[model samples]
Target chain A: MAGTVPLSRRNILTDRRRLVISVLGVAVSIGLILLLEGLWGGLRVQVSSYEENVGANLFVGEKGVRNFLGEVSAFDSSAVDELRRRPEVKAAWPVNTRFIVLDFHDRKQAAVLVGSVPGGMGGPWKIAEGRPVEADDEVVIDRALARQHGVGLGETFEILGRRFRVVGLSSGTRAWMLGYMFVSHDASAGLLRSPGTASFILVDSEDPAATARAVREELGLQPLSPDTVAENDRRLFAGIFGGPLNLMVIIAFAAGTLIIALAVYSMTVERLREYGIVKAMGARRGRIFRIMLGQTTALAALGFVVGFGFYLAASALITYALPQFWSHVSPAVVAGVALAAGLMGFIAAFVPARRVSRLDPASVYRG
Target chain B: MDDVAIRAERLEKVFGEGDVQVRAVRGIDLEVVRGQVALIMGPSGSGKTTLLSMLGAMLRPTSGKVELDGVDLARLPESRLPDFRATRFGFVFQDFNLLSSLSALENVQFALNLAGTTGRKSRERAEALLRGFGLGHRLSFRPEKLSGGEKQRVAISRALANEPSVILADEPTANLDSKIGHEIARLLRNAATEEGRSVVIVSHDTRLKDIADRVLWLEDGEFREINEMAVDPVCGMAVERKPETPHYQYEGQTYYFCSPEDRDEFAAEPTKFIPDRG
Candidate 1:
């Protein structure tokens, strides 16, 4: 009986080209999956992070609210005072959200207009430039929209064909459906032609459940906690973009798996004679299969490294081009991509390895 | 009696069935002892190669028994055949089926690896074998880079890597030039005689008669004793004859031929041939 030949590291490493190609295929597939997943995850995180920082204890809105961004809820302005009078409510304020077209430097751009009272709980914006919105005819624009429209502080911009002064620049705040502009209560009403009407009411209360109960009883309006508001935002986003993103991820995974499978299958077929010779030399079927799998795994590992590096460069390019669009390169995402790539390579090599193992040495030798 | 390294009893191989059936080997009974080179010679379709395959335990007989060293090969499972071939018998093909992807040394080492020999020892053994075959400098060259004779030599080294009890050569020298062919024959003969291994060669080349201890002539799926004159008809051409001789009188002339068919050929044209009275 002949003894077994232990696997050689030198042979495996020296055959770097095959290993690199296989790894690259796996890595590209996994990196694509990770990119898609990370993009989706980053969007979710941005949305939730924005909502959490808003400091809203409860949100008053219309029943069956579908689009929360820049949509009118038709709550009376007097309801704010009535809700604030409740025992559990510490403060209540009216919020006006509407869409308006802006004209700056002869360029027209559409923007979501948000209105809040001066010195109120939701009034002071996190300004990125210039001063906060204080005057009735003054507004603050998001940095992205500001740069796009070439508008600066103290510059007057026309909204809905009415001119208003640009008071400041704000950051980390955007409407769900459109780029945003922050304005005083009077200016927002003028833009919408609706006085004493707002989209929703924001409450700052220590106990949200109690305040929500109070608002429901006194004002006959449903009060939603910030968490519920975030949840609604998530549900809305998912309804609009969830199906396509999920399908994209699934298709990406499937494509990656198929690519790896084809690569491995072709490689196995090419090396069929070599495999037969090895088997004839007394290599057990299991060992041959393992060597093939190792080859695939090694290739996939190389691909993952290259793909991740490519993904990082691509993400950076995207971030540089569109600063507002979040494109994160997370280690977890890289690792997830690597794992997925490895698995794809493993699965892809499986059928071919089995075919190789089951091949008759006698027949191959005859051929 | 010495133990038979390979023994086949009434071996039969039939291909297909019904009208399309072809009986490859009718019934072959033979015994090969250790340290002897046996040659099976016949024209194509004479079941010479088929018999060799059956004896090497590479193919199963249709209705017969084959035993190697007292182990019944006919009853052995299909899965066990590879192990048996790897450990008990080595094979040399005419085309020198060396793997093109592997260097000559690696090709030999691959065989050692399959036999579960690994590490520095496998390399050392492979190097020794290659050096012994005078291929020390050609170890790194792949099959495509090597000459035909070198490839055949590497193949021979691979076959002998596991130190099997028997070596089966199927027209081993058919693809080589006369010089290389003779060299391969000498190597095979040396393996049998000096290394104490049984060698079974299937070839139509009668030049191998000198190296073979016994020559079995297969014709139409049956083995027949070959007359030395029949192997090489020209007199004094290093022919080895059987003890008995059969002669035929044609047109008042005595004709000497090996088989009945040769005698019939002579009968067809009696005046064109002279009688061999010796």
Candidate 2:
């Protein structure tokens, strides 16, 4: 009797049902892996996009800023002026961030309203519908928030027991804590009942490095770079989203691996007698091992294709529903999923290959 | 001339140690010549299959040497045994063990591929072998689709694909119908005589005796040359004679009764006691 024969593409394609099932299992597994990873990627991008649009060089808060969730920030208003007088500083402005429940047209919604200085970098209030806030009793609303609450330009809304007129509708402005709104410094101070004080100072500098040094020395405030701010937001999002995402990815991988492993294992066991026959015919053990491995890899590759298609459909649905938050599907993530699936197939084929290799050709001949 | 393709020297195979030891092949010596079809005939549990396995290099003898083509199979390393089997020996089974997944042609091609023949040449050779076995139209048919005779022919083609020196068939006709069984016996005999290849068949089927160049009888782990006068009068049983008894002949056929009881029975009713003399 010979050993096992070398695997060929023809052998794998010979059984269409096994091929389809193996591929499907791989696809589902890879798709799930891509989905979880994509969500993680999307959250990172969204946070960075928000921070980049804000144009804030340093955020000076009342310490333990993460605990407040932008509800309140207490710092002396004079710190802005002191930071502005330094040679490295180009301009400085006070910013007050407050989270409030607004009653608009009989609907109540949570919103983050930021108090910005007139003509300041901290303000992202580009008027798309009406105009920027001119009087203390007026405010600006983002497009998404206005649509959700059914409030438009020239409408008045009550926030934190104070009535404010919606003077403008803005684009590309979102508050990190809640949704989106913008108001003038005095109106925000009055609404929060804080007098002559702002939450944090936003600074633009002649040179960011020099300005960073000046703020540290003159104002006793730690300067946060734009990159650092984005990083902070990422960490914050991870704190909230990491556990569920990790759990989903781990479970999906395990299930996919087990499904492929068991399928391949059963198929190999069923083919054991055939393997003995082929081996007795002079097929090498290495060749037999390669054939089984090839089958597994082929199945995994097929599954990855289907899985990526599913991921694309899912991503389209999410992007359509939440257009404001940056959501995207990437090929790298899909490839990663496919790789994971292939690895699972390889692992699953290991034990079966061993069993085939150990089968004696003489047993088949014995009557 | 030492024309032996397979030679066993005092071969021993013990199943277990001490109390449970079953001496399957105990100190038996045999030699099978090239181009000869030797039939090892025995009842059940006679260790004929075990002896064949050792001679075929499928099993290692416990204490003695079995050689094929002057190469000591017992001393051959495990790694080299498969190569030895592939290039020097072929095997056929009673069950016609063809892989169900492959067509008859592919099954034969699989053997060629294992022997390192690949691509167009392998296919061409496999097709030629199948066509020679009268399976030209059934070349693409899987084992399940093929008839018993077809499957057996495919098995024979697979066995001969490597053109080995010897073919060891363990009860090749056991699973076939009488007609198919006779066909298989003829095929084995033809392969041995026409192809000039040594074939060793282990079978208790008396039908195979006609096709065999030599038939060796095995009983209680021992083998003896079966001559014309050693054949039993009833049931075609072959008897080993003691020194006291002489051989007997009747109607141009030789007969040997083991004892006086058997001789007395034969004397009273000779026609009823004797098998067909042919």
Candidate 3:
């Protein structure tokens, strides 16, 4: 069209200061949503990391035990021996896992305490420094937790009123709010007061499917694969934290929509005279609406670009400053955010477009 | 082709309802032939703007009809009105109304674009129009950068961009000094005379009468005979002579005032406000 000026672009660019402020407002809201979603993604991965990498083919728990967190499971220690005797099961070992709060220098830190037999299937897969737990008094804690609490090798921390020396600093062992603390089976048995029972029996077998079926039928206990156990752990974590995280994301989205609405509405109101002039010059309501939508979409897209950049920097800073939080920004997460921004743009354009539509074209003559 | 470019028959506009109804334009008949400049002069509360708006198809008449190019504008569907206005009528506003965001050339091109003209053709046409208006040197300047005269010239260029058959102007010279105001009036007149487009202007500026082929004086939503109306020497507002109207005898001529304040102001210094006497 001959008169198809880039009115939206020109209007937004007219006031550089206002445009920057509007973009930043939207960027902040978008950044917050991205951060929350990334944190949620990271949490899902971290919650199940240990079980996924524990090297056990299957996990034998109490009949009703669903996951390690928020669920208690303990079976007779004799079950481990019975499982090892089966030809389908190559080996079996008892492992006890529970939540415990450690007090170091009068500061309390929550952690998932894991105890297994020396050189067993269930242990810290990767040690960043020091050595694994070998003695009842020795413990391997997450490197992030150890560094956070200023605990080093040979330093003692009180767990369940018992003192234990830090033996190793394990890598990738911290969840968002909790870290992993590894100790000996005897030590965990003593700490949890279940010396004759195992929380779970770790099974190693070449024919894991046959062994799992045999264990379920003969042993009469719930046996789950490592992958199933890890997935259950993830579901448990999501069930606990999903509501709050989703609520925060929704609040961020609403804030972003309002920011776009405020900016576009104000711009439309300020340029109402020009709109009237255009209407008088034979520009239709549809054309005026297009101009408003153009401005809104431009604002949202710019904010998204800026917000994505902000998320990258902020996520890196969070990981560097507080190593416990792992923020993962995936392509799907970014695409979801882009779709949300587009929705925000459309919703924000409504109020301003309606206002322009109701205006009288003849009002231009009043000037 | 119709020699009468615009013919309005008993146009009426009533705002509000019942007791609060405002008859903005009432039972006014008007006609403008091709190449004619018709000026509608009135006081502040008169219906000149309303009539002009109706004539330009910007506002629907409460009753009666406005005919342009042998088609009754009031009968056209709402959806078709914008295109009709874009291709058949040009509007010049008191404030120039050039989009502040667009350059002088782009402002003109915007009109062509609205009329389904685009690309290089629109650009060349817009450029030629601006250059004809002596704004060739300021093609890229936004509205705020242009002087008042330059802005009005740009507005005129935009009005002429779609090659409309009729030009509807509301107070086109209200913001300019006498020199520039006369120049703008002459431009509108030339647009009518040289291009054979009929021009209808609603303004209080008496200077526009110099180029107007027909001058209509409106008061209280109705057009009165121009000879029966007096221009207030103080504010240049058209005032109808009535028993209660503010009147003063000045040099053997009876002058009517829209208000006593204007009458008092004029009574104090008749000579000072008498140069543009009507």
Number of the top DockQ candidate: 3
- Candidate 1, B160-272: lDDT as tens digits: 98898888887787667779878888998989888888999887677788799998888789997665444323221122344444456655745444555655665666545
Quote the positional error of residue A287 for candidate 3 in Å.
Answer: 1.8
Answer with 1 or 3, whichever has the higher TM-score.
3
Candidate 2's DockQ is: 0.28
User: Residue A359 of candidate 2: its Cα lDDT?
Assistant: 87
Q: Give, for candidate 1 chain A, the lowest lDDT window spanning 10 residues.
A: A1-10
Question: Any residue pairs clashing in model 1, and if so which?
Answer: A2-B115, A3-B115, A3-B116, A3-B117, A4-B116, A23-A299, A23-A300, A23-A303, A24-A303, A281-B114
TM-score of 1: 0.79
Categorize the docking of model 2. Answer: acceptable
Candidate 2, residue A101: how far the Cα is off, in Å: 7.9
Better of 1 and 2 by TM-score: 2
RMSD of 1: 7.0
Give per-model CA RMSD. 7.0, 6.8, 2.6
Candidate 3 residue lDDT tens string, A1-367? 2246788899999989999999999999899999999999999889988777887889889998878666788889898888888887778989999987767678888899999887886789999999898899999999988888788988887889899998899998876679999999999999999988999998888899888888789888888888888889888888899999999999999999999999999988999998988888888888887888899999999999999988999999998888889998789989999999999998999989999899899888775
Candidate 3: residue B38 lDDT (0-100): 94
Q: Any runs in candidate 3 off by more than 4 Å, and if so which?
A: A1-3, A85-91, B228-278
List the candidate numbers ranked by lDDT, top first: 3, 2, 1
Fnat values, one per model, are: 0.26, 0.39, 0.79
Off by over 4 Å in 2: A1-19, A55-74, A82-93, A98-119, A123-200, A282-285, A320-329, B219-221, B224-278
Report how far residue B245 has shifted in candidate 3, in Å. 5.7
What lDDT score goes with residue A1 in model 2? 18
Query: Model 1 over residues A1-367: C-alpha lDDT tens digits?
Result: 2343323232345456765665666667666776667666666655554347656778887655534552457767888877777777778778787766656677666666778888775653477888878888888888767776667888886777777888888876654324667788877777777798877888888788887776677667777767777777677767777899789877877777776666667766776766666665556666776766766666667666777776677667755566556655467766776677778668766877788877766553354
